[model samples]
Target chain A: AQTVTQSQPEMSVQEAETVTLSCTYDTSESDYYLFWYKQPPSRQMILVIRQEAYKQQNATENRFSVNFQKAAKSFSLKISDSQLGDAAMYFCASSAYSGAGSYQLTFGKGTKLSVIP
Target chain B: DAGVTQSPTHLIKTRGQQVTLRCSPKSGHDTVSWYQQALGQGPQFIFQYYEEEERQRGNFPDRFSGHQFPNYSSELNVNALLLGDSALYLCASSSHMRLDQETQYFGPGTRLLVL
Candidate 1:
């Protein structure tokens, strides 16, 4: 079984600044994927960015980037030049490479991010 | 393209009653997955349906059942609903059952209130 953990319950960052949300997971599988999802006040879950375990280089999506440390089982999301619109509940998810629709995802508790003006 | 959609944006029901939520997968998508998200918590996988059959399920009880139609639309049925069951129910759809790069696109979700 895979378990994802987000130690930070809440985080805040000033406008134009940057914020990093921490995430860790426990899994025996060597090949997998990690994702960061954002849920705004609208209650819609939006995919932010994704990282493939096979890729040593982190993934970057404009203002969103990730620092994926496979050895440490850590995958953190970094929001650059944070804007007020970035304020939301961020969840970290892990998915193993498998069939049987076992491609299920294990998610962390989430970190509530607040962008300050 | 039309994204995944869920019907009855909000619903209210009394305990011990039954409720059914519906979902339509994204255009060209054949797989539908359901998730439950409680307040202040991340979404938990409920089940996935493909070919009008349940392909995988999470740890939820049997009281929580579902169905998939030939149109790729799905329904989640919860019997003897409890107050604890009140939460946001999300529907996601993916293109295929492939082992790699299978990203699920989610709907806005239906908010269920078990009074």
Candidate 2:
């Protein structure tokens, strides 16, 4: 079974500062996908970033990036220039192929982020 | 374009009752996946439906069931609902034709509260 772990239950960052959320996953599949999702009070799960196991280059999207250490089985998300809008629950997830044309995601408990204005 | 959508944004039920939640996939997407998000926790996968059939499921019990229609929409039916079944149910959709095969986009989710 694929499992993802986020040890941090809560974290806070000053506005305009940066914060990092830690996540680790275990999977036997050599080729899999990692993702970070953000859910606000409104309850929508938004895609934050994505990383492929084969890619050595860390995945980044504007202010959001990931430090993916394949050997360590760690994928942590870093948010630069954190704004109040960044305050939300962040979840780390992994997807592994179950069968032909099918993939299921396993997610961590999540990290609650608060931005101090 | 309209994104993934779920109906009955909020529901209240009691133990031993049954509830059904619905979802409509995003445009051009044929696969739908369901998840259960407990309060203060991440979402757990329930199952996935494609081509009007169940293709994959997670570690949930048989009480949690789902069905996909010919139009690629889906419904999740929970029988004998337990207090633990109360959570935010999310629906995600992805297309096999996409380069990133598992790039699922999620809906706002339906919040179910069991008394």
Candidate 3:
């Protein structure tokens, strides 16, 4: 069974600043995918960024980027130029490649991020 | 593109009652998955439906079941509801062709309260 862990329960960042949220996982599969999702008060989960375990290069989506260390089993999210709209609960998740299982996501508890003005 | 959608924004049921939650997959998506998110907790996978069949399920008991329609819509049915069953139920959809990449879009979950 694969499990994701987000050590920080809460995080805050000043507007226009940068922040990093940490996440780790336990998985025996060599091929997998890692993802970060944001859920605002509207309760809608939105994809932030994703990283493939086989890709040594990190994944970057504009202001949202990921630092994926496969050997350390660590995948972290970095937010640059944070804005008030960036305030939300961030969750880290992992899933194995197709055929391994049902492709269900294993998510972390989540970290509530507060972007201060 | 009308990312996954779930019906009954909120529902309340008493103990031992049964409830059904509905979901419509995003346009062009053929697979639907259900998840349960408790307060202050992450969402847990309940089951996945593809081709109107349950392809994968979590640790949930038989009390939790689901069905997928020909149009790729799905329903989650829970019997003998318990207070512990109160949570936000989310529906996610993705394409089977892209299962390898696995990019699932989630809907605004349906909040279920069992009193």
The top-ranked prediction according to DockQ is 2
Which residue window of length 10 is worst by lDDT in model 2 chain B?
A: B95-104
Q: Higher DockQ: candidate 1 or 3?
A: 3
Per residue, candidate 3 scores C-alpha lDDT tens digits across B1-115 of 6778899999999999999999999988888989999999999999999989999889899999999999999999999999999999999998877644387899999999999
Estimate the TM-score of every prediction. 0.96, 0.98, 0.97
Q: How do the residues B1-115 of candidate 1 rate in per-residue lDDT, one tens digit apiece?
A: 9988999899999999999999998888888889999998899999988889898889999999999999999999999999999999999888674544367878999999999
- Number of colliding residue pairs in model 3: 0
Give the C-alpha interface root-mean-square deviation per candidate: 1.6, 0.8, 2.1
Off by over 4 Å in 1: B97-101
Model 3 docking tier (incorrect/acceptable/medium/high): medium
Where model 2 places Cα greater than 4 Å from the true spot, the runs are: none
Mark the regions of model 3 whose C-alpha exceeds 4 Å error after superposition: A98-101, B99-101
Best lDDT among the predictions, by candidate number: 2
In TM-score terms, candidate 1 sits at 0.96
RMSD after CA superposition, every candidate: 1.4, 0.8, 1.2
Model 1, A21-53: lDDT tens digits are: 999998888878899999999998899998889
Error of 1 at B76 (Å): 0.6
Instruction: State how far residue B98 of model 3 sits from its true place (Å).
Output: 2.8
